[model samples]
Target chain A: MTPAVTGVAVTGVAVALPGAADARALLHPARPGAGPVDPAALIGRKGLRFKDRATQLGLHLAYAALSDAGLLQNGELTVRKDRLGAVVSSNLGNVDTVCRAVETISKESTSALSPMDTPNASSNIIASETAIRYGLRGPNLTVCNGRASGLDAIRWAALMLRTGRADHILVTGVEPDNEVTRRLVDGPMADGGAAVVLSRPAGTRARALLGPVLRTAQPADTAHQLVRQVPGGGLWLSAEDHPVPRSALRNALNSWGELSGALGVVQCAAAAGWFAEGNKSPAYALAGAAGAVLLAPEGTP
Target chain B: MTYPILGTGAVASIGADADAIFDSLCAGRSGLAPLRAFDPSRFNAQQLFEIDDRQTEGIDEPGRATRFLVEAIRQAAEDAGLPEDLAGIPVLVGTGLRELRTLELWWRDGVPLDADGLHFEDALRRHFGAVDTHTFAGACSASLYALALAWDLLELGEAETVVVAGCDVVTESMFGQADRVQFDPPPSVRPFDENRQGTILGEGAAAIVLSRSAPAGRPVRGRLHSVAVNCDAHHQTAPDAAGVEDAVRQAQAQAEVTPADIDLVVLHGTGTPLNDRTEAAVTARVFDSPGPALTGIKSLTGHTSGSAGLLSLIVALRSLERGLVPPIAGLADPLPEAAELRLVAGGPLAAPLRLAQVNSFGFGGVNAVAIVGGAA
Candidate 1:
């Protein structure tokens, strides 16, 4: 079945990757950092000392996305609280907390476990933490779809806008570089995230228009199908590290090495930035095994 | 734009199928028993209502949660009379904490970390042939969110059919956490009772196949009217009456129903002092007088975490079909402070039930409410 096509707009975009502190840096990266950057300064030093690393990444990206959308000025939200929804996507959500909780429960008495740190073990707490910190009172949803979480979240947020569920939805994809996730992957995974503000098509910062999000069975063929479907000499942005000799292919996963949940949105945001800078080509992002979304410059059709 | 629920499937402690579970519930059969899945002798509250894994003896899945989910989904799919081609259908599963025992085994045995938390979705995709799969983990209300997502997909015409499932198995890690926090009850789950101590955690799984319209000749179990989810932003562990009340009001508004229209309420009564009291207050606020029949199935199933919400949905559907709302299993005396709302006790209450509301509250102040209508 074809999804209900609505006039959804990409009002703002942001990223929290290594070396690049904000959305602008991700687009214009003079030197990509070799590893994850400590986001303590961006999140401030007062109250977030005990927060999990994933939550810190989520907060930084949420604020940056809202700020880029002009919804936040001086750290205060410009729009009404109830009209803004928050959806956080993650593959390995707060794995550090889970490992810690399990280890604590195994070794020490259950009573001795740190009550403050135990709440962070849950997957939904990341979104809840971001919402509580920023006072976002709209529908808060936490989606986990492995690598495809970011792109799926983008699609879901667009539907939320189309159905008038929220005036503007802040969608984020985040994962932390921790021991648990690292061990699970048998290597170091990048710790970062990407966020975008989805709104009605009539916004001041409408940089790109979202197309249909298609979910195919095979991840191997997703990139090719997505690239072949979009015809008009546009760019194809993807999280795939290597490509098959495609001229319009631009690999964002190389610079931002392997952000599991954050890969798809990062590609989409970077592609939007390229389009904002006079590149009229449509950008297609293939989120591994999940699906793909084709983003075109405003008024492309 | 009404989506008909084609069928419901469950693998709980009481029974393995929806019909048996419904029969057990209506007959006032309690599934509560001492923990058998694991030796809970050393724990604070050494009692739980665990699903009998022997029934699923031939399943090769390593994780208990995965096994239960696969069986439940198969039953639901068969009941829905699904077509041979299963393409273009999205699968949404909700879980809490995952299978802790298996993870611990893998962690301590130095096994390759390939069995990540998202492995369950991969397994479902491979075994069930569902290309579009997603998982939700919002504590006790996770599966409700899964069902809500399926509803949205159907309402938006994103998919013709969607399978929403939820499963979770109690493990030593969970029991240890609860014991450490002193949240375990000594006897049993006595919901809304004056002498309630706490809750006995349990494990189970359930699935519902939702379609835009009912099948050609199959029976429609119920119709999902509306669902609303919200967060309190209050304390992480504490119960918030205001948030629960807000969620109910929003659900009622969306469903276009008032307290007078509600014939029954399936509460998320965890049997804890705070949760029961907060749930009672929210029910009283919604209805000025003694509201519709209020009951909780946690007394029989224990708290199944992720699967609790869908299990409660199954119980509500059963109640609507049988016109009998089951009483609180161990609730001997209702707390006078929470007596403003009618609590089904002693035995099943027979009434012409039409509309029922299901409430599910999880950690981190997450509250979800959904309205379901009986068969037309």
Candidate 2:
């Protein structure tokens, strides 16, 4: 069943995946912040090192989101720390750090590994770090629903707003497109980050522009659909009844196959991919894996 | 304000399924047995609420804990009267240490050193199918923490229903660590007894299907009026006697229901020297006159680690249904405070009903108390 809008609205959306060929230019501008470098300007910043690809992507997407909403004012994000919530969702919490730590403690001598980055590998480190970095004191939650991480992040943040937990929530789905996540996930690696600013009722100019927002989860034919994706990633209606859009294929991550959880992240990021839809007439947004979240332009059927 | 419990499931010494297990408890049967599974020959103690070797003739397969989760989810769904499929539901799983038996026995014992804590999602995703989120909270109070999360969601109207579960299985780490801490009992477990030994090792899982709308089919199990969980921040493995009282007070205040409203009380009753004495002291202060009947499951179920809160909750619900309070199996001669409340030894009872409280406080001072009753 669709939740009644109850005056809620989406004000802004942003996405960033550090060094994703495209994010590389955004990550390393010739000048620190000279409006982000273009492909032509990508020449000077080749070896700018980041601690972990996930962190780099997380910061970039968060910044992009802040920029898109014109919420960045003099280096300060618009959302107040007290009224904002953060849900930075990831499948593998700092996979690079986890691999390194495991190798150090279990296989190799404990002294061989720098006991330093161990804390960063913890699951909620990203959420904790994000909250510490920004003064977001609202709900700092870390959600894992496999491929539904991104969509779940959006769903959770939106709920927080609707529940009066926060005025506007910042939801970012981040995972390094690293080799470890790729091998472990066993399918194509989903390496990117996406961010959205979900506002309380009547908080956005988009409130005047949006039609009506609706969210619902289609059932798994079996019992365990959320944690584990279904075969063929759940039943997709080829839509002889409604003409399934080509865009749905790009955003679908319903099954328990490889990257099912990460697919939710991808869909959330791609939903804000305004550039991906040049000729398409329908506006769209999505986040989550198990119970895939479908956010279309206000009035779209 | 009271979110109804639409469905429930459990795994314990009595049985794997809810009906079987609850029936065994009502019958006053003891689930404690020799530690046969995991080759207890190498260990010091030979007692536990082990459910492993029972696979051949009793439970189906995949060990007890995993089976516990699978069956519990199925039963909870059925109990809640939801459609057979799990496509649209949201689930939150709680555990202190997940798949402890798998990691400690398989990963730590024989595997390559780095093979520990492998990708856990494959199994979780496979079992839950279409969950809203997959959360693994490691705190001792993890399961009840999940309950609180589900409760807040339901109250806020974010979702009408949520399936909540807490599970654990016996593991070498659990066995070794528990033994190292000198937390084991002598062949048997005794809570609140003057000559109480230590705790007996136990592992199991419990799941509950909760919704804003109460289910109509089954007799009303119990109403969760209020739940309050607090961290002690005291010593890691011990609880402050005074803090336990505060937790009860917090829950009573939050529910706006007084201690007098409580008709039955389920203590954490860890059976440890400090824990037993503290639980007794706290109960005395909470209910001075006509105190609610006191009962505990540690004797029957051992200690299921983090999963104990929900497990005890299931028993409490069952007690409310039978119109009787089940006995604390191994409690032969009870402590002074324990005797204050009617210890329904020998079998279940039939009256003085209305309200009950279930307490589960874990190491690190993580304390959770759930108050329930007919009016609640």
Candidate 3:
């Protein structure tokens, strides 16, 4: 189904990977043993003490994305706070804080738990704290919907914008790699943030035009259908392992490491970067074994 | 466009399904009891609304919350006359703490924890053959948030059918946090009561099957007119009256109904002093004096966290169909702020209900309100 609001444009993009300057850097493989940069240096240290790693990365990237979108001036939002929204996706955003709270409760008692750190344990803290930091009074949602979360966040943002809920929405996908996450997963994971400022195309300079996001229960068939929609020499990026054998299909996880919830947004940012660099071919990013979305350069049919 | 409520299922402390729970509510049944999920001696509050073992004998195998979710979904799908394998339908599950209890178990008991099981997608895929699943963790209002998204998907013609569910099992960490936060030990949740202390966490799950059109031979339980969600961005735990007012007004506007059109209001009513005062003020400001009958389900359900909103939605639906609004159990002296509002108490209020509104606010200032009407 076609979305009510068409011409949804990517106004800005931001990336917070180690040794990477912009979203374009995500298209290439990361340097060996590269880790996340210090978030304190990027977003300041005032409210960094009690925040979890994922939230910290989210704040920094949100600020950068808003700035890139020209929505921020002198550290204040240029748009009305109530007209701006935020949608965040993270699989293990507060695992460390939650696990620690559980361990503390099991080992000692509630008295040992710090009241200041209690709010951080809630799963929605990352999205809520972002809204708090940015003064966004609009709708705020958090998606932990497994692999498809990043794309799901984008889809929700698109829906909100098309439905006239918000004029501009900041979609963020972030995940933290810590002792708890390492213990939970068997392989290395991406430990950074990616964000995009999505808006109606009337007043904004479009970096890329977002197409309708397709969600299905059948992954293999949907993947094939999406691949067929792309023209020859077009870009096809996927974070999931599909059976399709197109040589041009780039595995986003192989290049950027295992992003988990950050995969879809990161892939979209990379696609936007590709469009920014004057690539004319259609670009598609697929993930989560359930969804796929198309992106094209501005003015493309 | 309103989406038809094809079917609904609920597993709470009061009853196992929607009809049973609504019946229990009408009969003034209280699910509050001595805390048995964990050691009560470790916490200040000794009561919680835990699901009975008899209700979950064969289903509580994997994780309590996951099992509850699967059972609720199965019930909903079966009631909707859909096959067991929900191939094309998308499942949206919401929770404040998805697997925190299991994580706590793994942390304390050395249980093997598969990272994939942390999210409900794998469990849903394995049990119900649901290939497309989305789990929302937007704190207490998570389920309503899922409902809002599901409504949009149907309204936009993105899908023909969708299942929205919310579940949460109270973890020791959450109970401990509440225990440390509350100054007094409350006997039970007393929403809008003059002596209300704080909220007691509950464990349960609820599901609803929504479709673009009603199925043949199946009763259309209710109509989901509209749902609106917004963030207070005011505080982490505290609620803002203006934010709550905005969400309510937005939902009413989207549903194209005036304040007088609403017959009942299902309050979030966490029973905390601040939440009750704020909610009462917002309700009075939104609706006229002695507005639609106001009732809170958390008094009996004991604040089921993320699932609380869906449970309230189910209550609203049942009230519209049955023409009986359940009273707030254990409510004696209502708050002064609620004087201008009709606080249902002293047994069920029998009235011909049509339009009803359900409110659900959560941590991080997330507020969600849904409007529903009786089947005509």
- Among incorrect, acceptable, medium and high, the docking class of model 2 is incorrect
Better of 2 and 3 by DockQ: 3
lDDT of each: 0.75, 0.57, 0.83
Best first by lDDT, ranked: 3, 1, 2
lDDT of 3 by residue, B255-336 (tens): 9999999999999999999999999999999999768999988888888999999999999999999899999987899899
DockQ of 1: 0.45
- DockQ leaderboard ranking: 3, 1, 2
Candidate 1 residue-wise lDDT at B57:
39
Candidate 1 chain A lDDT trough over 10 residues, lowest sum: A236-245
**Docking model 3 quality class:** medium
lDDT of 2 at A167: 79
TM-score (0 to 1) of chain B for each candidate: 0.93, 0.90, 0.97
What TM-score would candidate 3 get against the native? 0.95
Q: What DockQ values do the models have?
A: 0.45, 0.07, 0.65
lDDT of 1 by residue, B1-376 (tens): 4578887889888888878877776666767776664434445566777776644432212377878888888888887887533456887888876655456545644433462455366667666777787777777898997887787788787788999999887755566667666763558788999998888778789999989988676798899988887777676678778878888898888889888999999999998988998888878878878679998988888899988999899889989988988888888888875777789988889999999999998887777898999988
Candidate 3 DockQ, CA atoms: 0.65
The true-versus-predicted C-alpha distance at residue B58 of model 3, in Å, is 17
| Over 4 Å off, model 1 | A1-4, A27-35, A220-230, A241-245, A294-301, B27-43, B54-61, B99-101, B111-119, B183-186
Instruction: Judging by DockQ against the true structure, name the best candidate.
Output: 3
lDDT string for model 2 (A126-235, tens) is 55445444445455555544544555566656655665656766677766655556655555454555566667664434311122222334333211232122122212
